[model samples]
Target: MDSCEEGKGIRTLSTVCEAAETAGIHMVPNNPVQVLRFSEAINGNVRLLELNPEVEKSLKQGDRVVIRGLASDEAILCTESKSFEVKVVETSNTMLLCRDIQTPGKEAFTASQSAGGGLIRQEVCGSACSYLELRPCRGHLSRLAEVLSEHQYAGPETEPDNFVAGYTFRDLLDLVQGSEDELWTGLKRCKACCIDGFWRLLSADYFEQAFDRIVQSLAEKDWPIYEVPVDECCELLTDLLPRVIIEHCLTCYGKKNDNGATYCLDEELVSQFYAGYLLRRVAKFNYAEFMEVWQQTVPLGITVALEMLKGIALHDLTARPPVVWHFPANSLPYDVSPRFNALFQERTKWTLSDLRPYIEDLATPQQPLEAILLKHTRSTMDVTGQKLYNSRHPL
Candidate 1:
C-alpha cells in the first residue's frame, strides 16, 4: 500500500498534468516542466492567475481566461484590465472654483421650479408641484384636498379658500420680510385670489420692479397679496434680473428652424456645451453625482445645464469685480452699489459689459467652446493631446 505522502504527491502530479492538458500542452513521459505561477492583479484584490508557461503563451495581452491554482480545479475567468493613476501637477483656480460651485442640489432645486415644479417633497421650503408639471394645475388641487381634510372642511357649504384669517397681505408681507422661503410659504397660505394676483405681478415684465404698483393694486383689488418683502426682495431681484438676462441671451444661442423665424433650443447641443463647460470649469467634477442631482431636480438636461453655466458665469462676473479691462469710475452706472462702483474707482476697469462680446461669441459658436473645455480637462493630465482624459476617474 502507498503511504499518505505518496498519495499527496500523486494528487499534485495529477493536478499539474490536468492544468498542463487544459493549456493544450502534453507532459513528456516522466518529465514535468516547472509551473511558472503568475498573479496579475486586475483591480483591487481580484487577480488573474496563469499557472503554466503554456497558459501564458496562449493568452493575448488583453485576452480573458479561466484559471485555477494547483490547490483545486475551480477556475475564475476575468478580462484583464490595466489601471493607471493619473495626477495633475498644477491646480487651476478656474477649475477649482467650478468644482466648488457646481452645487447639484441647488441646480436641481432651480430645475424643479423651472419644470413648473414637478418635484414635491413634504419638507420643501415652498409649496406643491402640479400633475402636468405646469403652473395652475391639479397638483395644487391635491394640496387643497389635504388641507381641507386636515381642517375637516368637508361640508358642501365650506367654501374652498386660501385665506389666513386675521392676516392681511400687507401684514403677512411684513412677517416674511426677512426670508425668501418665508415669503414663498406665506404666498402659499394666502387665498387663491391673492396667489393669482401675486403671480400676475411677477409675470408682467413691466410690473416686475414696480413695487408700489404691485402693492397698491393688490390692496385696491382686495387680493390677499403675499409677496417677498422689501429686504428679501433684493435677493429676488438678483435672481430675477439674471433670469431675464439669460432668457434673452438664450435666444441667440438657439438655432432657427426650417421656417427661419422660429427658434429651437438644440437641447443636445446645449447639453454638450454645458458638459464641456462643466469639464472646463469643475476640477473634481463627478459625472455620476452631477447626473444624479440633475435627474431628480431638472431632467430637462439642456435647460438646466444652460442655467448652470449662466449662473456660474454671472456670479464670476459680479462677485469680485472685473479684472479684465480698465475703465473710469465716473462712466459707470450711478445707481449701482457703491461697493461695486468702488471696484472701478481707482483703475481703468474692464466692466461686465466688456466681457459680453466674448461671451456672445462663444455662445454663437464663433469660438470653439470644446477647445476651451478641453483645456481644462487636459490641465489635469501630465501629458497632452487627448491622452486618457477622465477628470473624475483616477484610473
Candidate 2:
C-alpha cells in the first residue's frame, strides 16, 4: 500500500494522509488497503456498451430506443429522434466487470475488516473483449415509397370504407425503421395522406387528373399560377378531391408565401410532376420531341428543363432517336453498390448532377457526394470534356 504512494493503481498514501489532515474524508482509513478475493465461478456474461452524449441524454430522459432491421439488412439503433448504425467493436485491453469492487476508501476497507479480518471479498462478474458501438446513420426510409404504394388513394369514389384498418402511423413506425419525426417527414415527402385510419400515396392517374383540374381552374379564374390562393383552390377542388387531399397537394407542390395565405408552386416540383406524367405515359420519347413536349405540358410561363428532371426521369442519348424515359430515382436502391448496378443497366453513363439525386441520401458530412462516386464509380469525360460517371464494376 505504501509502494502505491507514487504509482497509478490507488489513491496515494500522501493523498489519503492529506485528505485526513484537511478533514476531506470523515473516516480516513488508518491503513489504505483492501484485499480482493475473486469468486470460484468467474462470470463472463456482462456486456459492455458505449453511448454518445446525445444517446446518453436520450436514455436519461427515458426516451424510446430500439434496434430495427430485417434479417437481410444491417441493424440500426434508433432513439426517439435519431438513428445510428450498430457495430460490434473489439477491444485490445482486458476489462473486468468486478462486483463488490470499490476504491480503497475507509468505508470499503472498514466493511471488509468487519466482514473477514481485512479481506475485501469481490468477484469478477465478467470480462470484456468487445463492446457495442454506435455511429450516426440515416433513417431507413427507402422502402416507404414501395410500402405506401400498396394503399394508393385514387379518389373518394374509388376509396374503400374509411374505417378499414390499414398501415396507420403506428403501423408504419413498426414496419419502417425510422423515428417518428423522420417517418412523418418521409410520409409528407411521398405525398402520403391519412385516409380513414391508414397512410397512402395518391395514385398517379388520379393525381394527374387532379393537377389538370387545378391548372384549368387556375387558368379560368386567371389566378396567379405561380402564387395560387390556397383556401379558394381547396374550396373549388373539394368536390373533385377530398379537402385533405387537396391541401396535401398544395403542401407538396408549393411553398407557402410569407403570410401563409397563398402557396407559390415550386417550379422544380411542378416541372417534375408534369415531366414524370409525360415520361410515364410513354415508354420512350425522342429526346428532341420530349424536350419540346415537356416544356409545353407544364402550366403556362413555368419553364421545364432537362436539369429539373434529374430525379424524375432519365435521358438516354445512346438509343436510336436518342430517347428519354421515366426512370425515377425513388425506384432505385439506397445502397450504393446495387444502385450503381441499376443505374448502369438503365444507361451506360451519367453526368454528376444527373446521378446525385439517386445517391445523395447515402452521403454524409464525413462521406460527401464525391467520395461515394469515387469509391463506387469510374469517371471519364466526353468529347466536350464534361465529366461523367460509370459503374466501376461490371454487372
Candidate 3:
C-alpha cells in the first residue's frame, strides 16, 4: 500500500536507486520508460519489495507506507517476482511529453476565451510551431461557415451564426497539405472578411504549413527569411525605408537626360536626395559641434535630419515648375566664423586654435564632395542606361 505526506518543504527519508536495485532493472540515465498503460490508481504506490528491510518487517502487505526522494527516469523492476500491483497515493510536479492530441474546435474556443475581447488574439498554434490568431466577428464567422458547411466533417448548421463550431489545428494542416495555392488564395481573400483580423483566425497548423512553404520558396531562390519576431520585423522595415529610397533612385533616376542633365523629378527621390545633402551640409558647417550632437542624439539625429530634408524637398518639388537647386558650398573645415568663435569662447574657455584641428578632423573632406558625387552619379548613369535598354528588349 502507498500513502502520502504533505508538509512545507519537509525532508523525508527515502531510498534512492535501492528500488531499481531490488527490482533488478538495468537502464541508462535519461532514457524514457515505456509505459504500456497508465493506471491512475497505481500512482505513487510502492510494493513491499521496494521498501527497506526494517520498514518492510514493520508493515504488512495491506499497511500504508510513505517514502520521499528525488524523481528520476529509472524504471522499477521486480527480481524475485514477475509482476505485482501497487496502489496510488500521491503525485508531484509531473510533465507529460507526447504528440499533441487531435481535438477540433477545442483549441480555438480555448484561445478565444483567453483573448476575451473583440480584438484578435495571436498565439502559437499546433505544437507551438507557428502563430495562430482568432478572429471573432460576424464577417469571419460567416466565411468560416460557408467554407466548412459543405465539408463532410463539418457539424450540422451552415449559417454564419452557427459558425461558432471552431476549427482544429489538424484540419488546417490537412487543408494546406492537400492544396497550398488554394490556401494562400483563401487567406488573401479572407483578409477583409473578418473584423477581428483574418490571420488571427488561422489555426496553428495552417500557420506552420504556410510559413514552411514560404521559407522553402525563398531558400530555393537563394533568399533569406528574417526570423525576427513580428515587432522586430516592423522595426527593421521602418529602418530600411531610407536605404530603399536611395537604392531606388540610384537604379531608376540616376541618369542624365537628353540635355546632359541629371534630374530627380520623382518627389520621393528628390526628398531622399535632399536628406543626403543635409547630412553632408551639417557635417560641413560646424564639424565638431555636429559630431557632439550626433554622438548625443545617436539614431534620432539621422531620422530627424532625414525627415526635415524630406519636408523641404516635398515643398520645393510641388512648386509650379520643378527647379534644380544647388546645395551651398561648405566652408573650410578649419575656418571658424567670427560668430562661432565668439560663441565658443563665451561658452567654453578654449581658444580658437585649440579647437580648430579637432573640428577640421571631424568635417574635413579628403576629396571634394562634388568629385565624389560626380563619380557615384556617373556610375549610376551607366547602370541605369543598361537597365533601361534591357527592359525595352528582354534579350
Candidate 4:
C-alpha cells in the first residue's frame, strides 16, 4: 500500500507539470535566487566560488541543490550528503564541490532552503522554474483596497509624508511579513499587492484633483499657449487635457518625453502654424531659442515630412491664394504616384471646374455672395492662354 501511495504522489506531480505546460506558463530568471559562477576548479571535496553574501546566507549545510551547465548527466545533491558540501572560503566567496571528482570550468548552481517532499521536483535543479498564475479578481481587489486604506499612512520616517501610495506598500509588507529582500518577491507573487497599488494611485479623488491641478497650472502659465475660444477649449479639455498634463509633469520632473499639450484642441481650435509653434516651445520649455538653427527649415521640413507620410503635402502662405497639393509632374511615392498621375492624365477631375460635380454631390448651400465676388473680380488664364473673369480659386 505504501509503495502504491508513493507512485500516486509521483504521478500527481507529473500531472502538475503537464498542466502548467498546457497553460502556456513558464518561468524566467527570478531575483530571490542568485546565479553564481564557479571561480576556481574543484579539488577533492571543495571548489571556490565568486563572492556573494546573499548566496552565502541563503544556502545551508543540508540544503538540496541542483547544478546545471556542468555536464549533461549532472545530478541533484544535498549539502550534507557524502558527495556534496558548501563552504565559505572567504568573506564574500563561497564554494561547492563533490568528493572524488573535479567539476571542470564555471558551473551554474541553484540551492534552495526547501527540501524533502515534492519540492525538489518542482524547483528541479535550482533552475527557479515556477509558474506565474496569479490573476486579479474582484474579491481580492475589494479586500486589498480595504487593507490599503487601513494602513495607508504607515511608512518610515525617511519616506515623505505626501509620497503617493507610501502607506500601501507598508501595508503589503506587513501582510506578507517577508524580509526586506523578499518583500518585492512576495508582493509580486500576490495579485492583491498590484490591485491595491493601482487602486490607491488611481482613486477617483486622485484623478479629480490631478485634473483640477493641471488645468489651474495651465491657466496661470505665462507662456504663449496658442489660445482657442473658451467653448471650443472646454469641449476638448476634459478628455485630452489630463494626458497633456501628465506629459508636461513628466517633462517638468525630467522623466522625459514631456511635450504635453503642444497641439490645439483638435476641432480646429487654433491654426496649424500656431500649434506647431506651441509644440516647439513646450519641447524646449526653458530655452527661448530652442531648435533655432533647425527652425529656418521648419516650413519645408513640414511640407516634405507630410508628403512622405500622407503621399502628398499642402501649404498655404495666404488663404486668399490657397496653395493646395502640388507635386512635380509624375513624381511621388510608388504606391501614390499611379493614382495621382492618373487623376491628372485622365483629366476627368483635374481642374476646379471638373470638381464642381463632386462639390455639388456634397449638397453644400449655394454661396450667393462668394459667387458674385468671383464673377465680378476673379480672373484666370484658360487653356488657350486667354484670361477669363469667371474662374474661382481652387481650394
Best candidate, TM-score:
2
Candidate 3, residues 1-395: lDDT per residue as tens digits?
Answer: 11242144322222223445688976444322222223333323222233444334435554423221114311221112111122332335432322232232456444544554122212222121222121111111113324433332211122266343333433442322212233333433332112111122323233223333322333344432222122322233343322222222222323334553222233343234334343543323333343344334322112333233321222133344432222211122112233234323322322233323223322213334333223222221243243110111111
Candidate 4, pairs of clashing residues: 51-92
Tens digit per residue, CA lDDT, model 1, 179-236: 2332343233321222222221122122222322323333444432222133233333
Question: lDDT scores for all predictions?
Answer: 0.31, 0.77, 0.29, 0.31
TM of each candidate vs. truth: 0.16, 0.80, 0.13, 0.19
Candidate 4, residue 170: the lDDT equals 46
- Candidate 3's C-alpha runs over 4 A off are 1-162, 165-167, 178-395
Query: What's the lDDT for residue 21 in model 4?
Result: 80
Can you write out model 4's per-residue Cα lDDT over 206-301, one digit (the tens) per residue? 333443344344455532233322333344455544443343222222222124424222212112222233333332221223223223422222
Error of 1 at 71 (Å): 84
- Worst lDDT run of 10 residues, candidate 2, spans 28-37
Error of 4 at 174 (Å): 6.5
Candidates sorted on lDDT, descending: 2, 4, 1, 3
Clashing pairs in 1: 162-191, 325-349, 325-350, 326-348, 326-349, 326-350, 327-348, 327-349
Higher-scoring candidate on lDDT, 2 or 4: 2
Candidate 2 wrongly placed segments (more than 4 Å)? 1-35, 39-43, 70-73, 92-94, 99-123, 162-165, 316-320
Q: What is the model-wide C-alpha lDDT for candidate 4?
A: 0.31
